[model samples]
Target: MTAILTFFTTLACIVTLLPFSRHPHWAIRGMDFPRLQFAIFIAVLLIANFVFLNKQSQFTWVVISITALCLAWQLWWILPYTRLWPHEVKETKESSPDKQISIMTANVLTPNRKVDKLIQLVQIHKPDVLVTLESDQWWEDQLKVVEVDMPHSIKCPLDNLYGMHVFSRLPLSNQEIAYLVEKEVPSIHTTLTLDSGDKVRMHFMHPAPPSPTENPQSAERDAELIIVAKSVAKSNQPIIVTGDLNDVAWSATTRLFRKISGLLDPRVGRGMLNTFHADFPFLRWPLDHLFHSQHFTLNSIKRLPPIGSDHFALLTKLTLSPTVGADQTGLESNTSDHNWAKEITENQSISVNDVPQVDNSK
Candidate 1:
């Protein structure tokens, strides 16, 4: 019993401390996720060590103290997502329908041939804009059922699982497909003309995540996000960027992205809204995300039901407000942030064509 508890205690301490370093490998950055799980495990270990281990030994006290401290550290990053912290984005008070925009972003797991559940959510939510990732030609064809309502569309269907398709009810223009980091991986950029005659620029991105099968390092993902952040920071009007960031909200990369982009996360003060690994509650995390400029206020944001994909649908309704920006101040970037962004850009760790292609079939 002592051996088991000691092994887990050492593991938890190492995992908790790994994310503090600047390493951008998947193995290190991946530790940024599951702070909640770490907290839970640490809490369990703290209790188990007390009950099962000898109290006379100095090792028991040392383990308990370190485990307790780790629990507090994990909570420090997680409490903001809960109800404890004040909302970074203000909830909409103005009841202006014309000035509102509702969007739904979903990852249609390539091999998951279930469209009915997703289609049903579309009907129920009736989002003005729908973005689908990991969608192939077949998934594109299946999604056309809603095209009659969402007339403006951009499609880039690929078997590589990085494919993305965007359909919007509002008029769209200035469309451009940019391969920011990886040549094969593409990001969709366009301007949506809303009913209020307001032009909002939208950048939809789904950079390949760092994993055993995907890109092994976080350099490509960081570079792509940093590029988009610089672009978003320059915009005077409202900008909406959404997709699977493949990184946790609290990660160093994501925090840097927010600082450079000057975008507000609706989930910051609301909830984590875990959307990935829909089948496994224990493994679920917030892989899918939406970030927007200060001019927008959250009208509604919720996690829709699982739609035959590994990710649950993310629906967000936001209103264009002039006064809300004062309440929800955009995260400002410091000199350190600018230097970090420049470093990621200059590294050029991953070539444009460095990523090898993968099979589409599951």
Candidate 2:
């Protein structure tokens, strides 16, 4: 029994460590196979330790230690989702009134027929901006009523699941549909002019998922994310990037993006607002995120009611401000730049002019 326990414990350690390495090869086809394999191995070991092994035995200490290590590793990945990290709200000196910008981002599952539920959610929130992923021509038409209220909008309707649509009460500047990965898979990039005349760049992405039926590899997705991150890092305007990233908040790629972009996640130190698998909340991870530059302060963050989609909508309100200086207090450190962004940017053929501009008002 001790031998059996030791073997399983060793296997669990191997499974957990396989996904820790920062290699894109491990992130294939909309599935982090290594992470999944590790999770399963850990579960098996945990069950064996509790159910099969004697608690008072010396072997049990070995099992507990192994289990604790695995749990610690898992917790490390989940740190960003907890939003516990202290964040600095740069002092404005004059007590500037909060400039709230409410946004609602939803991956309205393309095949989902519950349009009413989505519409209802929007009406209730009355968000300043609405971003929908997996939206096609039909979904666009269903949301037409909102246009009268929103006035400014960007629509990229495609039969492919990559279709994305953005509607905003704020004026749009340099709005374009960018093909970041495959030619057909597009992401929306635009500058939002707020009521205060402040401009903030927003990137709404729904890249091709890494799945057997989809891209079958995560290279394109990872590359696209890295490209956007690098671009935002160099931008002077506040950046608000949102979408169904198809990667978890705790994943290696996601952390790398945050570091490269110099963006702040609202979930850090706060609970993980797992948006996917709405039907099975416990099994879900945060795939939908609202990441912004340090120039903005989070007003609120929430998970909206499900609208017959695999993902639950994420709503976030941010108040924008200018960065005081590099020595600004309250800014959390310890973020690591893995040099992934520089490598991907070197090979990307991204030209802001190459993106297509569409006037949905027409």
Candidate 3:
């Protein structure tokens, strides 16, 4: 019994601390996703050690202390995502209809054939901007039925499953499709003219995940996020960065992205709106994310029902209240933050120009 407990205790501790390493390897970087799961494992082991292990032994106490610290460390990163923490993005008290915009983003899992179900949600939600990831040409053709209403849009459909599409009812200008990292992986950048004539810069990305089969290292994924963050730092307009980020809300990379971009997350005080792996409730994380500048306040952020995809759709509504900044403090990037972002991009074939600019012009 002690042998079994010790084995798992040691294993859990490794995963708990692995994420602190600066290595870009998948095994270490991927540890950032399951912090919640690791916390649970450590909690159970601690409970067992307290009840079964002989307290008189110095070794037993050491084991208990280590597990306790591991559990606390894991919770520290995740507790902020729960409702217990203060809201990072302020909620709108009274949102004006003309100043509000609803966005819906989903990773439709290219092979998913349930086109009608997804389209039904689109009709029901009627979002101002709709972004779809992992969509193929077939999905794009099926989705064309709604293009009449969303006349302003961009589509990049590919067979490789990195395909992306964005349909907007609001007027879109300076629309661009750029490959930020890998040549084949594409992202969309554009300016949306709201009903109030307010122009907002929008970026939709689905960066490659760090895994054995996909990206062997996290450098590419982190580089794409850092580059975009750098660009957003220079923007004067209201900004919206949304997509399947392939990273958890609590991960270091996500935090760095938020700091450098000076954008806020709606999920900071809300519960983890875990979207990925919709088929498995046991394994899920908030991979699909939407970050915005202080020019906007959250009206609502929710997870929509599954539509034959491995990820659940996300719907976020925000009001363009420029006054929110007076009350809300953003995550400002310090000198160290800027230096880290620069260091990460130094090796990559990335520059300020690599990040597409979406100015308010046709």
Off by over 4 Å in 1: 349-362
Model 2, 1-362: lDDT tens per residue? 76877887776676577675644553332233234345556766777778777888886877877887885675556544454554433333332333558899999989988999988988888899999999999999999988877989999988777789999987897888878767998889888877887777888887665666666656677777877776676666677889988877767677778777788777776677779888875567778988887777666788998899999999987777655423333222242454555555455555323433332222
Candidate 1 per-residue lDDT over residues 1-362, each given as its tens digit: 98898899899889999999877888998998888888888998889989998999998899888878888998898887887778999888875888999999999888989898888998988999999999999999998999989989999999999889999999988787778898888889888887998888898999989887888899888988888887677667788899998888877798899999899999987898999889999987788899998889889999998888889989999999967665677568889889989888768654323221111111
Clashing pairs in 1: none
Worst 10-residue lDDT window, candidate 1: 353-362
> Candidate 2: TM-score?
0.84
Once fitted onto the true fold, the runs of candidate 3 whose alpha carbons sit more than 4 angstroms away are none
- In model 2, the runs with Cα more than 4 Å from the true position are 1-11, 26-60, 83-98, 323-338, 345-362
The worst-scoring run of ten residues by lDDT in candidate 2 lies at 353-362
For candidate 2, give the lDDT.
0.73
Top-lDDT candidate index: 3
* Model 3: residue 74 alpha-carbon error in angstroms: 0.3
Candidate 3 residue pairs in clash (backbone atoms < 3 Å): none
